[model samples]
Target: MRSSRRWRRLCGGRNSMDHTKQLLRISDIAAAAPDVLRYRFTAAEGELAPFLPGQYICLYYEIDGTTTGRPYSIASSPREAEEGGYYDLFIHVGGSFTSRWLGQHGTVGTTIRASHPLGEFCITPETPRKIVGISGGMSVTPLRSMVRSIVDSDTDREISLFCGWDDPAAMLFREEFTALARGCDRVRVRFALAQNPQPEDKHGYFTAEDILRETDAAEAAYYLCGPQAMYDTLHDGLTAGGVRPERYRREVPGELHCPPYPTAPGECYPLTIHTGSGTVTATAAAGESVLVALERAGVSPRAYCRSGSCGYCRSRLLSGEVWTDPDRAPATADGVFHPCCSFPRSALTVVLPE
Candidate 1:
């Protein structure tokens, strides 16, 4: 019956609006690095949805009896997605719900719920002719897509990628990147090892100085994806070196760790969350985010990247003021905020999306 329903949905036998979520079956899995696995998923039927090379798809999982979602970057190129009817995702084992579940239950036949591709971290026609991609650790997933897309499309853009890994043995897609460079004259690849530096790899981190040495920072467009500390360091270094703020783009992997808001004496506020089930009132600690308050009340709103970049925990600020982390805050009009990085300044009434 499930297969029939899915087939009907694909064949336009029923209302197309009925299927909001796409069901994908795991077709293959391989170890990409130490504790990192590459998974390939295919639509149950029909062609897979088209996506930009660097966009991500949110995968839904049931954790501790609660359904939640985590976004994973598509590591495959657009050509691969269209020709192979599949998408590839590289996941690092970080003890998160999705990682734990994949470790135990990921198999050739396991089915999963996935949202359509989303996000804006990709190359465009407006992108500068010279591009620099800096990736650290497992954050290379999206860059892998971008590089593959550039190569497969035979784009005229000159691309340089500086990728770092913890160790030589833990380098994800090292061989593939090397081969890509060998095959493409327009591409240059560099690797850095943070620990136990190998003979072929650079000894230290990929710093801003290295970027300036590779290309004119003022004239090139840069794409950075990795930890927040890496982003901050490079952002500061580049800007200090005369790189314009609009010349670079960045995406921090997973949730953001925002410092506690400095509150005045006796400034703890109460947060009222309005959901479909009921209104739950919780204490918003001096430095805690509204999401934390909701979680304290046993209310789980759908969240993925806890960083405001994913916009997964966006809620309407019905009343009262909230403070957001300067780095992760969204540029929005009043009455809208992302609870993942927002802390209440006063008693607040928030309406969560259903």
Candidate 2:
């Protein structure tokens, strides 16, 4: 593990919050799509620490005196981390923090706190030789990193990318991906447009035939990142096409909205929160997850992949009743649950980390 001193040096004039947290200064900002901005953070003094190509970092911010954070994929390649001491991120406008603060008040030289690179969404030693990457909208960020890293390393591994969007203009990294495919024989790229596809593009969403035509879906490793609907469609389509469930991994970008509670009590419950420092009382909404209720009461717990996949916001359900999806809940022997997916059903007492 490398020290975050490099990041701290880059964020000069800012104080480091802790060993795990580092400040990042935005070095450049440019338009990536219609409502998205590609932000670059440059290292001023030392080299930016290296991270796995598809891994992400939690960017934290203080809004109205309360701290909050969101996870975003590092769009730049590991080669950039070594040579340029910088990385890129795509932020869509009109969200909670990214939209509320960065999109509105952020600019070149703006600074913020962030966690060290984290996540297992990257290629591992056990990854198969052939890879098929499927993405839509801003979800293309991580795939971009993997593609760029593979190209930069001059690896012999084969990659096939299928990007989907509403139209040609809505597709991101089109020019870059086109050039990459034209230059590298190991890489192949395809685009699927829901409307008005060009001569060589496919129409509508990606189908099994579309994927099978490019590569052997059953033999290749699959990476998926996109919206819920897109993920469901592609996953089912690929599974039906002989792709094994264990051969594929997915990461859903942006906020993971919880499903509506069919039998919600429809009443708020008193909540007692116990942290390392002390205990605080708040109200947990029956309809919302405990994570949302905590945030609503001005308490921000470290969270990533709000879809309940990442166990960042794991808290002990000391004394309470919560309805959670056993499939999505984290596996733990302790009396703990991921607040992001667990909704309070009655008055509760919970314990959180400092």
Candidate 3:
């Protein structure tokens, strides 16, 4: 664990204060759960820009001369962001980014570049007066932001949070949420434990029936965040129970488990890439994504939501074969491909639009 101050100082003199992105200092870091760390970040200079409570910010790092980025949800309230120009992020320590940098080389003075807040998960004036949130594991981060914002703003809106965890030890912000719920009559919190439930806790997962019984289900907007199985179960159940699709939204987790694609072991093929500058060649492994190969060769193509849901990294497939999940692929008449999710099946030549 060393501070990233040296790198930040080196780059801070450049256009580090660009409007779209800025450097943030790690003001504090604490363990929120056995496997999660809560990091508090503040602007390195001036004040951080305003953002909605449920929005996310993308963090970038230059690792071994290659650029990498990841988006994390803000868990702190909008009020806190306004007052101190700071926000909190709950990161799972097991991830490669956290293990390699935040957990190993991060310190209170460490500085990193972060994008302006960007996401559509926040509430708006057009939203319903009541919000019902369902979350599991680290997915609770954004929901926590909503709760804190509502409480801090003293808004008339109501919120009911239904959170599930393996046990008490894995629950995040338990004490803080308890205090908030106790002090604010507009807030209601419920916990469900899959194992070793306390007397006050629900014995198992919360079903649509469970949530509907506790809230004005017809009038409340639903926000869900969790694993794919949990989301599928609750989404189907809620929709079947008469909740309209327009009345609910879900956030994609950082790591998605896509179905296994065919792999060519011990084989690497030549990949020709055409950019505005000129044409270049790189080595692409059969099982690795085109984006991975590009980044390995120090090529940066605009990308966000690497799960294929976002089309930011879309490129032209001049000539090649790629395997991708049909459900996640965007329908296009032309040979447009998502480099982030598409794995090369044969030698490929692709065009990256400038």
**Candidate 1, poorest ten consecutive residues by summed lDDT:** 10-19
Pairs of colliding residues, candidate 1: none
Reference-based lDDT, each prediction:
0.77, 0.76, 0.77
lDDT of 3 at 47: 80
User: In the order shown, what is each candidate's alpha-carbon RMSD?
Assistant: 7.0, 5.5, 7.0
Compared with the true structure, what per-residue lDDT tens digits does model 2 show for residues 1-354?
Answer: 122333233233222323266678899999887878888986544445557768887777677766667788999987687777788988786656546588888788888877777776777545687889999877899999988876876446778999998867667899999999999888899998888998888888887667877788768988988887887677777888888887888884555345455545557899999878788899987777788777766765788666577677888888978887665674565678888878877899988966
Candidates in order, TM-scores: namely: 0.80, 0.86, 0.89
Tens digits of lDDT, candidate 1, 19-133: 2468899999998777888899999866676676677787877666656566889999877877778899988765575677877888998988887776767765556777888
Put down candidate 3 lDDT per residue, 23-50, tens digits, no spaces: 8999999988876788899999778766
Model 2 residue pairs with clashes = none
Show model 1 residue runs off by greater than 4 Å.
1-20, 240-242, 257-272, 276-305, 310-312, 317-323, 330-335, 343-349
